[model samples]
Target: MRAFREDESRRNAPLTAENATRVREAMRGISFAGTPPHWAELIAENNWMDRLHGVGQSSSRS
Candidate 1:
């Protein structure tokens, strides 16, 4: 997760004109799945705390 955050920050950093053009070109062919189709319903039906902290009932256990 830390590595993912670092990579996201690096991707969002300001780019030089040449780099910006290259980045734009690179994104042209990209296709994003954009959150799963059932994401909202799944989230609504599930307990987030359980998902986020496993099956433990307390922070101390985590």
Candidate 2:
């Protein structure tokens, strides 16, 4: 998540519109595979069902 935050910061930094778009695209392709380096607390709980089926978590609220 730290990497994602850093990428987000870089994307938001002052830059040409074209450059910003490229950074945004690059960040969109970034993924966190395997075990994370740190055990940071997740803001939302995750279920193994989604992970097993390769489906990402939905943003829907109960």
Best by TM-score: 2
1-62: candidate 2 lDDT, tens digit per residue: 99999999976555555654576589888998888655444532365546523322121111
Q: Compared with the true structure, what per-residue lDDT tens digits does model 1 show for residues 1-62?
A: 99999999987655555655576589789987777576656675357756634422232332
Model 2: pairs clashing at backbone N, Cα or C within 3 Å: none
The TM-score obtained by model 1 is 0.32
Model 2 bad stretches (over 4 Å): 1-13, 34-62
Q: What TM-score, over all chains together, does every model reach?
A: 0.32, 0.33
